[model samples]
Target: MTTTLPRVIGPWMAAAVVVGTVIGSGVFKKAQKVAEFCPESGVALSVWVFCGLLALLGGLTIAEVASRLPKAGGNYAFLRDAYGHWAGFLWGWVDFGIIRTSSIAVLAVMFIESLNNVLLLARLQYPADMEWIGTGLGRWEQVLATLSVIAALTFVNIRGTLIGGGLQMVLTALKVLSLLAILSLPVLILAFSPTSEPQPSASNFAPVWPSDWSQVNWAKFASAYGSAIVAVMWAYHGWLNITPIAEEVKQPQRNIPLALIGGIALLIFLYVGANVAYYTTISRNEMLDLKGTPVSTEFCRRLLGSVGVLVGSLILMTSVLGSLNGNILVAPRLLYAMGDDGLAPAKLRQLHPRFQTPSAAMMVFSGWAMLLVVAVAVAKETSWIDEKKNVFDVLTDYCIVGVAMFETMGVAAIFVLRTRQRELTPLLPYRCPGYPIVPAVYVLILVAVVANMFIGTEQRTEAKVGVGYALVGGLVYALFLRRKEA
Candidate 1:
């Protein structure tokens, strides 16, 4: 089997990948979840802003490292350079086995679920007695759709990162533009039609605590803010993925850093803007009391009418699809990297003769993703857990944990790199503005999030399980895999 490396992605396309992956289904869907914790509109907006800052800080640090190293494995490359082969291998293990795959699975499910909602609503409006339209598809149908989505994206990715990267840019732009249009229209309408009273509810624009600071729940404040950071950080997860394609980037030492910081700043603005728009059009109380279903989608329905609902649903579907595409784009590169180093089966290192892509590794990843979809579908059908807790819920839990693990380790790597690698090239092009301070602050915030994760064991049991799985996987790889390599 011959090895075929992908062409370098340029700065603009690299930025697109970061934006595309970071701004996916989570932004549209997770607003309701944020609302659950921070009911006050101002608080929610603040949370979004703060999360953006954290993302910015993390991105800056990653940009510095990526600029310096400019490798394909991203975190894996960072860890290997900073620490040792074992640390890098652990990052790869989790990324390939859990983080990327689970994320793709969850997004794929959301894509199907969002589409289902749109179809059901269309049926309800036009054909009053369309039973099949509203009815949930059987397990097999879901598995098929999930596989179909993965397979289609997998084929695109196998063509090479150039095509994949280009498609991601277009889809990302469309998704962002659609969201902004959706958000802006209602505000414009309300401004023009002053007589139209938007529904009243909790103070959407008021501060959660009075200016005096007397009413603050210092304890709950700490906890709520910490937990909110966890959610926000999760939403801001993909800033570091740019490093994986660093080798493909033109003038990576200069462009990778710029792309990382610029991409994250753009995402922050969009998230904050979108949330503010949501509050401006809909009241905080309505957002908070949005029961039985998610509020973000409902908010879209109320703002746009029937057409709005379909458009919002389509936007969300596209968002998830982009995220899935990103996961597929980056994850296989890890397998290829690992195989190159003889950490995994070398056959995975094989590149296609014609396509110049990792054909073997791509197939393996697609098959694994399909299997996960089947396992999840079967689990849901069989009531493996209470029907109340669906497979979607379980997988989301697993993904969060996996992501948290990577984040915690990745941030720690920032420190490790500073201390261990003295001989690396002089920092060039971009540097984290605050440097030691910014990275240090990010590490502290991450620690606080992990502490909060432990505190809310009941709510975040899945997160705990995810951590356990990561630790176990790391240990196993270190003992069996790493030792053999050594």
Candidate 2:
């Protein structure tokens, strides 16, 4: 008999998972990129808001589907059931091997890197001479720290869903409070004391539209807008992760939808408000040129001097840790789902006897992520690699095309199941708001992002990689399934 995971996560923890996972280091890292692409505070902020709306639309639609079919494989389950088993299998493979596992490595790297920032503020000479992945930055130390954290979290989660839920709650709470601090401190300093060192001027919000928008060059605008959207999309990426653990959620019908929508709504508020705080401290061009210095660090440096720098680093560490935990928790469940269906190695389907957790799958997933970390570290020094892009950026972009494409399928599954599967009609306890139009818009935007990928040179790297990844996944699945049958 197959062991089953217990329904231990409540509405609040589920929602916290949603919030914590989405608001990672990207908000701090990519806020500047958005400014680089859009430049004009008005257009830049508009892009952020527009992306939030798109995320919400996608969330609401996904919430409906998740509620209808609350299962472990969330996206994989939806795709398999709606399209075909093969469709879901490939998504699982891509997510496990590339998108999600790389995200874990990246978030862990960011976490350790931020922790290093904290140490530096304390006048610590720790890792002063270590440099393996990059020059003079203790890249080797960062890699070790990242792997240790991932290993620790994996063990904590190995206990069961209940323990993981508890850890998620605490991390999410700390992350949200830190973000609020980022938002509030700037406005507070501006409100109370203006005569102080560096305060935001009313002039920072000027030139509300892109300086080049008046020109009729569609190519430039598309490139700029697409790049900005990719950055924003990075921030909005993990809201869907909540659905993957839906089977472990108590009252999955109500909690799933509430967590999905509420978490994203909260994200919208935090993302936009955080940028307002960022712009309050740094001008658009300054934001663009902030190489090596984290945007949050620069913001905090301007606010509380030395103390703010430590605070900024701590905040980033907290955020990345939360995101890392969420990714680790979600990906194994996907493997468990696939394995349960005979689509993956049978060992992945085995749940721990006492814990009822997908312990084997978690280890497998972590092992893969560890390999990616080493691979990225190696790629950082390789001559053929793009000098401008780091391992995180390259890995993230490689999956961008796959993520956007799969997201469209997941959303469109709402439309697919609602019409094609008569039996599932009764299962949809929560109907998507706005019916066809809302999801249609979500899918259309994703379609545009995929199309935009082809048009932009920088984006083409990820696009070509994504296409090749999908094709390879399909080819591998066919062979694997054939071997199983044989």
Candidate 3:
């Protein structure tokens, strides 16, 4: 039986989903990592901006594709139409098994951790020896909080798309406002505080360039940029989420491009502005010292005192929570799409009769996500994995590799669609702006990222596991799932 769904999301709603998804845990926590590799504030800022431009270009290309094919199963639909069902099935397989779920779980855990930090700070005046609820609720407490948030949001999604969309919109506004406040705080404090240092002179404003090309190993620099791109691209990754709800968007063709491009532009501005603010107040050395430490909160505390710490924590929590919500909102549709294709159990496609939401699909997703959270948390608690390497880093390494594989395959799909369907070309509403050149550049950058995955000492196992998972996913689709469907 065919179901008719409501067009509850418009351009703004779609944009909010994209922005909310992209601005998650990365920005709040990843700057120090970026700073670690790039060293110079100017270089770090420039790298961020460059990543934004890359994201913009990728957005432009995908927008053109999305406008042409406004379907539920984003890259899956694109691959299916361009290549065949086998390719589409593989795409969906990787998406469901690895990329999307891992991302959501990682972000959710981060949000919980951020909130826990805020709560701990609030209770700081309590006697140091006193315990609120045995061991005083640290990381494990954060996990429980995260799971609670996930459960609540899952209920919202299962209840109805309208409620889910509304929550997204509200949270998106809060997140943006929080970011603006973050950017403005240092300037405001400098203006009002008697102890604030004077603004630097013009010479100080000049961008720092790396000198001594001999000291800078070109090979090492290339490898580092490649590695950095994985993190950078992850930060910029979710612009494509808009396409999943394309059918639910009013004027899908026109609005899809606007949402994708607009969201990327907004993120670009905020990222650059925030990084500039970060550099202005804190020395490069300070940012570097805080690498992989809980020092971000401490940095804010030093700059704005206790008030700043609270504010920063609130902003980070909201940012990650909004991001988790965005993921929850979009991920179930992948399962629903698979069910519709007869690749997955038909039960997953069932929509709530009254709410008109994918209740079954969302439930399955939430269950799987909860399992992942518990598994990772248990591993940490048992000391099976080092607490120093968080679940976020581990998942990111896997996701980066998975996403790189999909992106590589996706870029290839463009050429395949062009060559295989020459006669159907006139029907496409949008086309890539720079034709071969633009897509070619995207492929080059993606290749660089994949190569860089092997270069880094950190997160190497995660990267290997990611690649292994993708390969196994492809094999599963080929030998079992694809054959059954065929």
Candidate 4:
């Protein structure tokens, strides 16, 4: 059995991991929240564009960082090499226990929700009372379905990263084509068949600015814009995920940068284009009014009725599954790196004898994610929460502040590592274009976002909770894991 993971992922697959993982479930769902916060089409579009640009800056900055410390753990490696052992341990700790696992659970639940849509469209329903040992979970069928997907994807990734990467490429292609269809179909229908009923109209683009712009309160607007930016950032969250598997990429120096910059450029285009298509198809006011149905589902339903829903749901399910696969493929490598560093159980570092993948790490990550899914279900059923949030909302809110903090720190690591470049082993082949300015700007914006999250009423509780979770990791490390270093 080889102890090393093979460098099997090429440039294209690496890029697919970036684009595919970031696009999942966000544009379809979070756009509504963005629209609600921004209201005006122009404001919402600016938020999308602004967030995309920040993400691109982040990508460009991280490219140099990844090249300098090319390793399996991505940001964990960066934080460790740049700061110290405990910094890295905290990232791995929060990531495994909160961020990444919660992400997997959220995506799995979303996939199941899309599946439910398909079934409902087909007039098929699962047994209403699919009890799970009489535990009274929120919805047993959905919960079980979520676990099945997380498990299945874990198995696929356990087979090999190449297989997972290949699957990501195919799903990425399908999702891109699906998004293109969503972006183009409305215009095509209106252009070639102007007499069609319920066709997309030019008027949907009106009121580009809010009617109350003259009376707007700058303070309230800033808060709302900050909220919208966080949501949009979620849509852009996975851009750096590809870096986690740097050890498995064919040429880390070349491929990782290409993946980072090129992938983010494409994502910005696709995201903005898809949102424009949605707003034009369904007016801004209508989008704000939408409650249960996602904006994408509504756009498709309007465009092609029942058939469109099926198509949209299938596209979403595939997109989400692709993201899930990418997450599973990359996240375990972080745990493996942590184990290799003695921050986690040593067993997590073991690779599969035949597959050369982090089998133990994959199982642990997926199992925890499944547990989170169960936790959400039980919480809801037992009235543990005041609001009627789904697994996705609850988990995303729980982890967003932590994600923002780490991501900011990861980018900021650039400055610290630069001064200590001689001590770091690998010489960087790629340098960030704007150096101090690029990373500086990205860090500042994220700092503002994190601050806003703490200030805003809705996100304040979650932000505190997320920070508290990370602080607890510090306690765990000081008491137990820190002994390993001794």
lDDT of 4 by residue, 238-270 (tens): 999988899888889889999999999998998
lDDT of 4 at 330: 90
RMSD of each: 2.8, 3.1, 2.9, 3.5
Q: What is the lDDT of candidate 1?
A: 0.73
Clashes of each: 3, 0, 0, 0
Instruction: Give lDDT per model, in order.
Output: 0.73, 0.83, 0.75, 0.86
TM-score of each model, paired residue for residue: 0.91, 0.94, 0.92, 0.94
* Model 4 root-mean-square deviation: 3.5
* lDDT string, candidate 3, 1-486, tens digits: 345556888878888998988888777777777766776667777788988987777787788677667777688777777777777777777777778888878888877777666666666645354346333456676778777888989998888887887888888999888778667766677677747544422232234557655788788777666666666777877877887777678888778888888899999998777777676666666776775443346446667667768777888888888888988998888778778887778988778888888888888887788778888888887999877765676787677787777756666567777777676567666677887777778778877777677666664677788777767877887777776444
Candidate 4's TM-score:
0.94
Clashes of 4: 0
Candidate 2 lDDT score at position 389: 68
Once fitted onto the true fold, the runs of candidate 3 whose alpha carbons sit more than 4 angstroms away are 125-135, 138-140, 197-207, 291-296, 420-429, 484-486
Stretches of candidate 2 off by over 4 Å are 124-137, 211-216, 382-384, 422-427, 482-486
Candidate 2: residue pairs that collide: none
